[model samples]
Structures are given as structure tokens and as C-alpha cells.
Target chain A: AQTVTQSQPEMSVQEAETVTLSCTYDTSENNYYLFWYKQPPSRQMILVIRQEAYKQQNATENRFSVNFQKAAKSFSLKISDSQLGDTAMYFCAFPDYGGSQGNLIFGKGTKLSVKP
Target chain B: NAGVTQTPKFRILKIGQSMTLQCTQDMNHNYMYWYRQDPGMGLKLIYYSVGAGITDKGEVPNGYNVSRSTTEDFPLRLELAAPSQTSVYFCASAGADTQYFGPGTRLTVL
Candidate 1:
């Protein structure tokens, strides 16, 4: 069984600044996928970014990037030039390589507040 | 193309009541999943199906039931609901790797 952990319960960042949300997971499987999802007040879950375990290079999408350390079983999300829209509940998720799809294990979310 | 859709955005049920959370996807995805999200907590998988007529238990399967009689619909059932079952439920579908989610259903058990 894979378990994801998010240490930060709540985080605040000034608009236009940068913020990093920490995440760690325990898994023995070598092939897997990691993802970052954002949930805003609308309650819609949106995919932020994703990183494959085999990919050594981190994944970056616009202002959202991930620091994936396979050896340490760590995958952290970094939001650069954060804006008010970035204020949401961020979740770290792990998906297995072989199984029924969409069965992702998620970590306790980190509620982020972007201050003006 | 409606990626994923869930019905009854919000509902309240009394103890021992039974209701079903309806989910549907039009992308012809082969995989469908049901997850529940607790406050300040991550989403926990309740049930999943790889295809029609194939269902499997997930992380938190107790107090929940699911059926996949067709490819487009996967409904979750909660029989004799309890206070512990109060949470927001989400339905998702996957094509290959990326999973698409619905708006979610918020259920409160009183």
C-alpha cells in the first residue's frame, strides 16, 4: 500500500512571491506516477502538474513545477510568481502503474492563502 | 464533451437512510472510480471499476457499494448511512494516465 504525506497543513504566500508545498510518500513500487491537484472555492479538482517516477527531470507547467526525488520518495510542488488564483487546497497524489485507472492515493491537503 | 459528471451536488440524509450518488462520463473511458474527501483530509478511494461489470474495493470500501453495469455510469450506494459517512464524494475517469474529475457530491448525514 502506498501512503502520501503532506506536512504543511496551512501555508500563506504574498502575491507575486514563491511558495513550496512539501510532500512525501512511502511506496515500494518502482514504476508509478505523482500528481498535484488544486481545489478552489468552486470545489472543482484541477490537475496542476504531474511527474513520472522514471523521469529524472522535474515537471513544470506555467508557474507550477514539481521537485520529484525518487530516491527520497519525495515530490514537492512549487508555485512561482504566485497569484491570488493560486490560493486553494493543494493535494499530492500517487497513482500506481498497473491497476484500475483513477485509483489515486492522496495526501492530506495543504490549504494555501495568497495575500495581497 | 462532458468529461465527467456527478449528480445531486448536495444532499442530506438521516441515519440509516440509503441513497446513491450518480456518476457518468462521456469520454468512453474504461476506468471509473469513486472517492470520498473528508475535511482537511485527502480523498480516499471507495470503489473502482476497470470496465463494465467489473468492480473492486479500494482504500475505504466499507459502508459503500458500487455497480458498473454500463461504461457511461458508475453509481455509488450508501446503505444505512452513518455520521461517519458524511463527506464530499468525487467521481473520476481515466483514459491512460491523466484522470479527469467531476465537480463532486457533498453528503451530510444527520
Candidate 2:
């Protein structure tokens, strides 16, 4: 079974500051893909960033970046220069293609509040 | 392109009623999925399709049903509505490893 865990249920960060959200996963598959999705008040799910297991270099999309440690099975998201618009729910997901293809296992999520 | 779209932005159903949630994608992706998110929880897979006429059950697919008759449409059917079925449903289409999602359908059962 594949499980993604997000320990912090809620978090807050001041504008222009940096905040890191923690995530861990348990999967037996040697190769896979992980993703971070953001859901704002509008209820639209947006892809924030993605990390491939085989890559050693972390993935960065503008102000969003990931710290992926394959050996420790930890994939954390860092938001640099956070803004008020960054307030949303963040979910860490892992694609479990075991038998059933393209099934994503998602963490409970961390509600992030960006205050000015 | 309209990536992915779902019909009925909001719906209210009574117990024992039946309804189908419509989903379509213009990206021509081979993989489509239906997922539901309960309050304060992450999304759970309901059903998925690899392509036309190839549907499979997902993690939480007991009360829901899905069919993919074409490359662009995957509709999920709810045979009987229940209070537990009240949640937001999302449809997504995958191209490569990335899945693009819809705005989501909010369904409430009274």
C-alpha cells in the first residue's frame, strides 16, 4: 500500500517570508512521481510542482520548490517570498500504479494562511 | 483548450435519488479519473478510465459508477444518493504524468 502523510494540518506565514510544509510517504515502488497541488477558496485544484524520484536535483517553479530526499522518503514543499495569494490548501500526492494504473494517493493536506 | 470540464457546478439530491456527473476533456488524453473530497480531507479516487470503454474501480468506488464511451467523456453515476455522498467531485485527465483537473462539482444530499 502507498500512503502520503502531511503532518501539519494548518500553518501560517507572513508575507515575504519563507515557509516549508512537511510531507512523508511510504511506498515500495523504486521509481515513481510525486506532486503538490493547491486548492484555493475557488475550489479549483491547481498543480503547484512535481518531482520525479530518479532525479537528484530538486524541482522549482518560480517561488515554489521541493526538497526531496529519496532515501528518507521525505518530500517537503517550500514557498519563498510568500504572498497573500498563496493562502490555500496544499496536498502531497504519490501516483500508485501498482496493478491499478494512474491512481494517486493523496495526503490529508495542510491549510496554509498567508498574512500580510 | 478547455483541458477538463465538469457539469452541474452545484447540485442537491434527496436520499434514494439518482444522478450522473458529467465530465469531458478536450486534451485528448488517454487517462481520465473521478475523485471525491470530503470536508477537511484529501481527494479519494472513485473511478478511472485508461481510454474509451476501459473503466476501472478506484479506492473508494462502492457507491459510484463510471463509464468512458469516448476519448473525451467520462461520466460518473450515483445510483442512490445518501448523506455520506455529499462532497465535492473532481474529474481529471492525464497527459504524461501530469493530471489536469476540473473546477469540481459540489453535491449535497439532503
Candidate 3:
């Protein structure tokens, strides 16, 4: 079984600053996908960024990026120029592309507070 | 487009009762998913559908059921509700790799 772990249960940062959320996973598969989904106060889960394990370069999306260390099974999210609206629960997910029934395995999440 | 919409933003039911959470998508997506998020936790997949007439159990499907009769709609059914079933349910529709989620249904089983 693949497990995604988010060690930081809660995090806070001043508005316009940067914050990094830690995530690690245990998977034997060499090829797969890692994702970061943000759930805002509205309870809408939105995809922030994604990275393919086969790629060495980390993925970046606007102000959201991921530090994907395939060898160490670590996929952390970095939020830059954070805004107050960025406050939410961020989940690190892994999609078992190696399986027939591909399902997302998610971490417990890190509740982020972008303090104004 | 409405993307994905879940009916009854909030619902409460008694133990042993039954109810179906409705989900519909307007983007003509082929894949739909049902997930539950407990308080202060992440979302867990309950069920998913590849297409119409094809549904499969996910990580936490023991206490839930699902059916997909049309490409636009997928409904999750709870035959016998329990207190443990109290959680926020999310419905999502995806095309290829990116998934679009609904506002979610907050369900409370008393």
C-alpha cells in the first residue's frame, strides 16, 4: 500500500511571505504522479500543482510549486507571495497510476493560515 | 458550465436511515469520484466510476454504495447510516488528469 504523509498539521505565515509544507510518501513504483490540492474555506478542493516522478525538475504553477524528491519519496509544496485568500487545508496526494483502479492516496493535510 | 454540482449542501440523518448524495457534472467528464473528509482530516476516496455503468469501490467503501447510470450523474448511497458516517462528502469529475470538485455536501449522521 502506498502512504502519503504530511508531518505538519498546522502552519502559518505572514501575508506576502513564503511557506513550505512538508510531505513524504512510501511507494515502490518508479513511475507515478504527485499532487497538491488546496481546500479553501469554501470547501472547494482545487489542484494547485502536480509533478511526475519521472521528471527531475520540480513542478511550478504560478506562485505554487513542489519540491519533488523522487529518490527520497518526498514531495513538498512551497507557496510564494502568499495571500490571505491562500488560507486553507493543503493535501499532498499520490495517484496510483501503476494500478488498474487508479485512486488518489492523500495525506492528513496541513492547515495553513496566511496571517494578515 | 456548472462544472460539478452536489445536491443538498448539508444533510442530517438518523441511524439506520438511508439516503443518496447526488452529484452531477456539466463538462461531460468520463470519470467521477466520491470522497469523504472527516473533521480536520484529508479526503478519502469512497467510490469512483470510469464511465456510465462502471463503478468500483475505493479506499473506504465498506459503509457506502454508488451507482453511475449516466455520464452526467453519479450518486453515492448509504444503506444504513452510522455515527461514523458523519463527514463532509465531496464529488468530483475529471477529464484526463485534472479533476474539478464540487462544493461538497456536509453530512451528519446522528
Instruction: Please give, for every candidate in the order listed, the TM-score of chain B alone compared with the true chain B.
Output: 0.98, 0.98, 0.98
Clashes by residue pair, model 2: none
lDDT of 3: 0.90
- Model 2, position A45, has a per-residue lDDT of 95
Query: Could you tell me which residue pairs clash in candidate 1?
Result: none
Q: CA lDDT of each candidate?
A: 0.92, 0.95, 0.90
Model 1 regions lying over 4 Å from their true place:
A96-102
Each candidate: RMSD: 1.6, 0.8, 1.6
Using all chains and alpha carbons, the TM-scores for the candidates as numbered come to 0.94, 0.98, 0.94
Candidate 2, residues B1-110: lDDT per residue as tens digits? 78899999999999999999999999999999999999999998999999999999888898888888899999999998999999999999999898899999999999
Better of 2 and 3 by DockQ: 2
At residue B101, candidate 1 shows an lDDT of 97
lDDT tens digits, residues B24-62, model 3?
999999989999999888888899999999998887899
- Is candidate 1 or 2 superior in DockQ? 2
Error of 1 at A60 (Å): 1.1
Which parts of model 2 have CA positions greater than 4 angstroms off? Answer: none
Q: Number of the top candidate by TM-score?
A: 2
Tens-digit lDDT track for model 3 on A34-94? 8899999888899899898888999999999888888789999999999999999999988
